[model samples]
Target chain A: MSKEKISSQEIIDLLSAQTDFTKRQSEDFLKAMFGIIEERLIAGETVKIKNLGTFKSQWNESRKSVNVQTGEEFVIPGFRKISFTPDSELKNLVNEPYAHLEAVVLDSNHEVTEVDDEDTEELEPLNILTEQALEIKGLLSEIQGIPLTKDESKIEAEATVEIEENNTAEIPLESIIQIDPSTENLFDKIQEKMHQKSEELSSLEVVEITKDESEIENSIIEIDDNIEPELIVAANNEESKIEAEEEIKINEEIKIQENDQTETKSNYTAPEISTSSNVYEEEKIENHYTENIIENNDKDEITSIASDVNRVSEANNLIDNSLDPVDYKIKRKSKWWLILIIILLAIILGLIATYFLSSATRCWVKYELFSDENKEKTANVKNNILNIFGLGDPEIAPKPAKIEQDSVAIQAVAEDSIKVDSIPVTQSKDTIVDVFNRPRVYDEFIGTEKFGQGNTLTNISKKYYGHKDFWVYIYEANKDKIKNPDNISVGTSIRIPKIDPRLIDLGNPICLKKAKELHDLYIEKK
Target chain B: MNHKELISAISSKLSISKNEVEQMLDTTISICTDQLKEGITIGFQSFGNFEVRKKEERLSVHPATQIRTLIPPKLVVNFKQSNVLKDKLNEI
Candidate 1:
């Protein structure tokens, strides 16, 4: 057998020794510790006991079980079990001693011993009072097999017969005492005495057997065989002794009566001590006989005991099923580490999949912005496109990828004064080009005007160009001298630009048409 | 809303004139700018933190144009909202 387990009482004693508390106080402290932990679990809160483990509880589904003794099937529905997850430090501490041992593995072909079915019985007791009731039932069953008669004469005659049979079969006759109300009181007294005597004799026998089995073989046989006859004879003797004591009392009463005939009364008292000792010996013999029968026919007896065990198990199951629902709750704790690991793996796989899938197919423009030549060429093309679309100012439209690089490229193009194709060059009426001769510089100066008081650029433009819109050109050329074009001095000079900013890109393609016409005429003449 | 609307709303809520609120706001902006110019960290409790972080100079190539350039080192303002404010907004 394994080492005996420490009970709660032992823990209380140890706690009391360690602290300045009485045994009761230590016991209360232990109880409070468990109570708090249980409350936390019931509230679905995890309680972590430092250096030990965490305790958690959850509901579990119902399950089925079987009675090991009678092989009776039943359900042991759902119940709570407070579970623990040991701290890593504690785990390492426990495993330190056995760390060097490797795991044991066996070949599949190797045979292993199986556990005994009866030894695997689940042992759970009901309420304390209920258990006491069960014990009383067993006692009553033992008493039912006895016959207790108060009449000493009849009991003695039966005892003599039992003694005679004991001499022949060597079996005690206690089993023959059929239960009867008339003798139940006498039997109860006899049984109590016999219980004490049997206990003493059994302990003595155990010691004797352990010391020298061969030396006490005869005594063991005497105990195993004569139990029934001894029980019958003990009961008979007990009754006889009671009658003799009553006779003695009667004699005393008669003497007293003779002295006072007018007030004649009788008293009878039985001396219970002497009879109890004798009955005790007799019952011990009976116990011995039953033990012998069990030893000799163990296999057959076990089979016969099935019905009794079945009844007991059925009662237990009924009580358990009726009350366990409210009292029992199955608990389970979730392992967050397992869930965390799974989530991490899923994220990693998703990121890998996304990276590969996105990179598999993609499209984007690859612009060039390195060389000065490439910059101007691309800028001119971009400006031409922007001009045709009549978009906003080229300086702000079509944002460059790199600001400094684009600025430098535009600066180089400006300094070189490159001649680029314009979108629409609409010159004013005085500056139209001639087609019969080579193209020449159109103008050095278009016009000039003087500003006057209360003369805004719009009003001045209205006087010179017959429109208010061309005042922008007058303002652009004299922007250095004009603080506010609308607030010009009375005799201020304002120069007009030779190249109209609008005409720079607003001219029609009349020269191209005429040149094409001349080429066709020349070809026809040829 | 916008800058003007925020100023007017603050003015109404605080029972102050619009010009006073706007001037005070402008002063606050200038103060913050001055502090940032000296590379100081400013924090508004239960709101956010404004700090200047130094970015080291590095050579980077533009992917589209393959134009490589050397960027200069500079300081940038970093703002981090306090958890108190974040939670308040999340409640909505």
Candidate 2:
């Protein structure tokens, strides 16, 4: 996975460690790292981490980008992107170590003069209580006992806080005793006996309290401020949110009664040593070890962070060394060409389609309007065609196909023999019905049909035109006789007019087949 | 820990004269707490984040004592330590 990951370290190691480099090791390193990452990107995979960010590979699209100098458009082929984000672990380490730092002073002097630690044995009734500050810390633990943090400073502070919290809230202080009425009297008795218990507790303390009077007062007041009275309230408030008041009340009653009665030589009565002090001792030891490791780890982490930052700096430096500021700006400037090209292509395509719509309507008029059988059917088609041409005639008026035998009869009346009676479309001004009876010859070879509709004009055009696509062109030309181009009788001879040589080579005489081709080509150009 | 208690401890731990530390802790707490109070969530970059949830108001039961309880909405605290802290504490 690391091989696939874009890693400069892995690259350098491959070149400097396992693999020997003959000439430019750093260059080789770059090649190896870039090559692998590029290969993976081409394979289309995004690398992901369980608790980190994803490294995605994406490609840009090809487009008709503009040439900035000439404002001319050209194409820009797509390129790939390989991007990364810092892992959660790495990111966390990058920030400062948790603001508060605690370490065991294996090296620092006067460790004993600092925080006081308590002993665990069946000893202290009100352990280590002093002459001045022995006033607070009520009788015993409530049912939801206090958290026994090993920090003795917190414990001493906890005692001092009793005065401040009760100083005003004492108005509602009984509310707590009401919580544990059963233990209420017990606590009251314990409170009364607190001074005596302190003496007994002092005797049992494994660690002696030095008789440093001034130090005790100074530290006591400081610790008092530290011991959070509000935290206790907040904790209660937080818990009470989850616990029922009634249940809490009942439990408080039991707790108060049990401790109060215990002090009265009750059966459950025994030594009144506090258990919190012992819990604190255990925590103190744990804390010392934690501090020791934290310090050692701090050293290692500092070195690691320094190297990481150094490596990142080195990577950034390489980029600076390889590229010039001016070149970068030029490259950025060149992108406008890309933007211009994209917009231009989109617009060009839109205009082209719009242009075709205007021209394509001419095709529909040629096909649909010329096929209308009834004058009523022609109304809709005529109006549509009329909208385009203003007042011109139908390009070719609808008429019925004439049988080949009718040709001899048509020659007898050949001057005006066209079956024009069937057609009723308006003719254009200066329209010529037929100019010369001496029609030119169709140079293209003729077709022989074995199957398909016997549309006389269309089949003849396909055979002579060398393309099946022009079948509609023939239908369009002979629309005057072929009212419905879909219906036509075989062997029906039809008139074919001469066309320009570029379109069709009707050399000497324009036969019946040639005339239709000329007419179709004429309408197409128009 | 409740907001007030946690702030006090944090201040004491930093040991910046109480008043100054108190302000710092208060500002940080206020931002996160206000967001949670509004039933919104805040994302801290590395430290644990705070969010407000439905709290699941419900009827409670004590099978042993055959008691029924009607519990109301509650606000709970959740914490996730940063990897750096986890690793540092885990160092041997």
Candidate 3:
């Protein structure tokens, strides 16, 4: 249990201990058993051992890969690999710990609903409201082509004004005056003053209209010079003061109504102005121009008045067109400002959302990496990332062994350093220095090789240790079996022990000197 | 070679009875399986090493239907050939 790898020698020892066979017999049997399997595998035949496993040689096709450090592309030549598939009985035995687990069928519909739920959770009510506002704005822009005509504005305004007037009329002024006698005098005085001002304003307006007509007639007579002055005087004299006063009162009431409507709905001012001007034009035509046209016997006066009425209508159209564009431009400018602000807000919100999302993912990655429960999962993810970067081996089975070995080596080095510090300085300085400098090789064996014809210790050493001079280490490892350095029996198995990498590093001069010293010592002993 | 031929080969090589060889092989396999189940790596020198590895749970999709299935985690027996055996095979 203390040893990680049970070597072939150990297995043979175990087998001999378990049965009545000798060690040599057990070793021979084990060797023969594996030999037949290897031979069959080499012949491209599958060997199935009952209750154990099936061994087969698989041919891997040549493939392309890139070197991680150099970033160079190279082809990995095709080769055969020995693959083993365990028997179902053995597989089940090995998987007994995880036998309760079963493959779960993932429902795609359930996963979609889960994702939608997460999205709904992330959306706040304020965000939904903003989204609705944006939709309504889009619809308004789409419907921008249809003009809101003045007639519709006037009708709407009139309806609202009439409602207000009816509500005010319902609050009877007579009842208010009766309820508060002191306010009654004030109301009567205000009414009397308002009547006097209205009458004065009406008389003045009539006088002004008469004077304006007389001036226009004189101007026409001067232009024609064929018309009688008596006709002009009679045409001017035909205007009645009573009709003019009535028209003035109607104009005043219309103005007051328009003022009230303007206060209630300020946005429709352009349309209201157009409607009011139209009413004024109709009044002038009916009260002054039409009467003058009938009263004058001369056709010239009638034609001139008709022309004047056309000019006034044209002026009103010009005013309406000019005012409508100004109001529209103001509205469009305000809408543009609102749109710009909303866009800015949306961009800010988007930035904030991205920041939070990125931070959440980062926290998740950290949790995955640090949490003990997810250690294996994170390792797999890291390996996948390394593979993507071409820095990891695609075969994952051997990685754990390599990493474990590396950790053991690092721990051994740390322990050796600590041991060096604990050793007393009173001992021989050179031996202490040697102990400190010596690289320690742990009890690990890579594999074994049989002593075949023409195979010397040096050849075996060179094959495994990468240096011909490192033969002494191999002889030292197999000193119990190999009695003499130069002589060895054929077919004797030798365990190729793993050595400390620092002890045989070719690039290190110290390592090379150590190997040379060991060679000299072995030679002198021989 | 098949199982019977393998038993005969080992019996002939070891100069033992077929039954003895078969019994010994079965004992050896049982011992090896027990060790492997305990998470110990059994290395046969130049031949190969047998160990148990844990295969993590993963989501796998079917190629034709694209149905994702969650494959549960399980312990698997894996065998990796030693470099010496690989070289020997290549030489052959």
- For model 1, give the TM-score of chain B: 0.89
Off by over 4 Å in 2: A1-447, A450-463, A466-526, B1-81, B84-92
Q: Across residues A21-117, which tens digit of lDDT does each residue of candidate 3 receive?
A: 8889899999999998888888889998899988989888999999999999999988888999999999999898889877766665343222223
Best by the DockQ measure: 3
**Tens digit of lDDT per residue, candidate 2, span A234-291?**
2345322112222222344443443333222212111111122222322332333243
TM, every model: 0.17, 0.14, 0.33
Give the C-alpha miss distance for residue B80 in model 1, angstroms: 52
Instruction: Report the lDDT tens digits of candidate 1 across residue range A1-526.
Output: 1222333465466556654557775454444444444445555666665444455554456878899999998987664444555455544443443334332222221111121123222122224446888999999866543423222323544433433343442334443344233234443443454444334433443333332322122223222322123223223454332222232233444433332321111011111111222234323433433443333245444434445446645654654454233222210111332333235434654554444334322210111244453455455445444433334252433222332232233223222111100100110110222112223233455666766665667776666655555555555567678766446677787775554332322233433343344435533554
Worst 10 residues of 1 chain A by lDDT: A418-427
Best by lDDT: 3
Each prediction's Cα lDDT score? 0.41, 0.35, 0.58
DockQ class, candidate 2: incorrect
Question: Which segments of candidate 3 are over 4 A away from where they belong?
Answer: A1-3, A108-526
Determine which window of 10 residues in candidate 1 chain B has minimal summed lDDT. B27-36
Give the TM-score of chain A, superposed on the true chain A, for all candidates in the order listed: 0.19, 0.13, 0.22
